[model samples]
Target: MSENASATELTSQYTAQVTADLERNTKEQERVGVEIAALQEQLASLQRDHTVLVNIQQAIDAVPVPDSTAPPSGNVPVPAPRKKAAPSGRAERTRPSKKTRPSRKTAAQPAQTAGQTAGKSTGKSAGKSAGKPSAGKAEAVQTAQATLVDLVRRHLTEQSEPRSAAEIATALGQAHPERAIKTTVIRTTLEGLVAKTQAQRSKQGSSVFYTAADPSRSAATARSEEQPEPADA
Candidate 1:
């Protein structure tokens, strides 16, 4: 009887796992579908812009450049040049005196540039030395940085199931609108992470998904989610 009970429990567990995976897969499909639709819309807009640009270029090409021989539309006549009297031999001999200037300014320019560079370096060093961040500020600085891979890895860790690159890009973009997150960048980062074994990649039919490096984390998350919440007192 115990053997039969164990078998039934095992079957039930498998069923639950299968169910969870199925549901996750469905959600992923829907999310990717939405991202694909958005991408298509963007592509259409870009194509329209491209068409407009091509038309403008063709129009520009069709217009011939005006030539010098052509008369002006205003019908303005060219003015004759006025003749000037030539200087006397004495005046011509007494040309403006050319004084040789000392290379003071030219020589000083390099010195001034060097001084400015030194001053800038000194100021930077002084600021870095004097205006040190407090422990909190230092931590915050480390927390908010330009490392996209770190950001993507952290994002993946928080997710229960694998996520598509488009979905990840969209989520990150919405969360950090100023950053202007892009799906191509996300996909490239994900590929690098996978190569490093810092992230896991899985495919469902034509769709690819990424998740945390740890394979078992997703299973654990699913189990936890499946667990019922405690009833109200």
Candidate 2:
């Protein structure tokens, strides 16, 4: 009888211990999940900030630098030439000749990019325009896009991990709100730019983050082996 009682007690103790261990493991798992969620949120926020910064940097790069000699504001006087030109019978080349002209009508002002829906100079104008990107201004837009794409590529390369488009845009917007970046525009630009950059698209569950890849001579070289080689090559 005593032996039977001892066995029962031992079994009970083992069952209690197993239960305790299971509960402890569950709690630890919950904690880990919570931590992961927090980290993901933090990472997303950083990505948005990065995107905003990239857009702003692109805008800064795109905005043509005005001829300093022909200051937009005439308040600042340009220095007068010290020596008068010695006249040859041929028309003398004037130092103050208006050689440089802005390429576009709004060359004096800022230009817009594709998918940028906001005010002409404000974020509002770009939002309303469903108009396609112009063929004439394609070169200018491409130039701006390239600058922004390069900035984003560099930003990703500098980061230790992948980043979400929203996070990238938020970072860029915060860095340069004056540029008036729209989240949609940022998202679209990043997607298009990624094609050129050959950045890695990492999927954590359903969420996608872009991881910067090493830039080779061309993006084709950076492509995954799964992708087919270009026909031209």
Candidate 3:
């Protein structure tokens, strides 16, 4: 009977020890799980920081380096760093004050003073009397009298075959360096002459060419037409 009691007591003590050990193991497992979670969060933060640092390094490398062989011009100027703006809620109002408008009487006084000054001044008449014929005015009068059509006609007549408008404008420019001639003006003038039957125009591909009309042939044709037909003979 005593042996049976001793065996039961030993079994109960063993069971209690096992239960205590299980409880300690459960608490240790919970602590380890929390540490693992904290480590994962730190790793994620470190990875994000590493990525940001790598991007900054790449941007710095992308900047161009100045040539070392070139001469240096004193100290390089550094731009001032911009200041950070204050929070919107904390910012102070900086609106400008309204400006006053000028009175109409003050505005009219300037005009009256200007008119009185003009009435007292007789310098304009003296300036007109002292003025002589300017060289620029004389040159302008000469250019006005010079006919561009006559010049283009002469150039076409001098050429053996048809000439392009660009060639004519270039020849005219070379002949009269003072005049600023354009190909479009020459082309318009050629078209005008073609309309008036004073010049012949031919198109070869995309180029338009001009030739002076034959005066002799035209005169002969006119004379033949003028002579009355000899009685149907």
Candidate 4:
């Protein structure tokens, strides 16, 4: 009977130890699963950031490179390079230079003076020629008589639908190749016209559009105002 009880106690202790071990293993597995989920979330975030960076890089790379040798617009002249000054020190004053200085009355002086005079005359003539083109441009502008605002009004009236400032400026440019029309100028003019009740303004998304006000309504209002109010009844 003592031997059987000792064996039964040993079996019970072994089963309890196995149960405790299984509980610890389950807890460890739960902790590992939580860590894995956290790591997966971090990995997803990193992937999203990586995609954004790649798209930005692609956009930057797709930009066109400007021509290096192309001259910029406008006839602004490039300045000449400055001449280097002679070194001022006591180290090399004794040695005579290989290049001799010419006297004021040398033949080279007369030739240089003549060349300088010719250059001055040429510069004056060029300035006069440039002035003529500007004068002609002013004359043409005066001859146009119709201001930019008038042009914009005409364009808006001609179109059945409202037009953006950029569209109106493009149309103005096409119609008048001699004029340099800017979208900003057109937008400001449209806004001014709106303030004056000459045009109606509307906005769609980020774009602003303009349309001519109804002339019939304005004419009717003018006529009503001009008519006497039945001598105040």
Name the top TM-score candidate.
Answer: 4
Clashes of each: 0, 26, 0, 0
Candidate 2 lDDT by residue in tens digits, 1-233: 99999999999999999999999999778556544544454465567666756665565556443232332332333344456566676445554455573345444233233213222234333333322223324444343322344556666777887888888877776866655556555555555544444566777998878877666634556556458767984
Name model 2 segments beyond 4 Å from true. Answer: 69-233
Summing lDDT over every window of 10 consecutive residues in candidate 3, give the lowest-scoring window: 70-79
TM-score of each: 0.34, 0.31, 0.33, 0.34
For candidate 4, list the clashing residue pairs, or say none. none
Question: Positional deviation of 200 in candidate 1, in angstroms?
Answer: 1.0
CA RMSD per model (angstroms):
20.3, 22.9, 48.1, 30.3
Pick out the ten consecutive residues of candidate 1 with the lowest summed lDDT: 70-79
lDDT head-to-head 2 vs 3, winner: 3
Tens-place lDDT digits, model 1, residues 39-124: 55456545655665565556545554434344324333334454465578667655544565335566567556666666666567
The local lDDT score (0 to 100) that residue 175 gets in candidate 3 is 95
* Candidate 4 runs further than 4 Å off: 1-143, 220-233
**Considering every candidate listed, which one attains the maximal lDDT?**
1
lDDT computed for candidate 4: 0.69
Q: What's the CA RMSD of model 3 in angstroms?
A: 48.1
List the candidate numbers ranked by TM-score, top first.
Answer: 4, 1, 3, 2
Q: Give candidate 2's whole-model lDDT.
A: 0.57
lDDT of 4 by residue, 45-95 (tens): 456556655655565455554443443333333344544554777437744
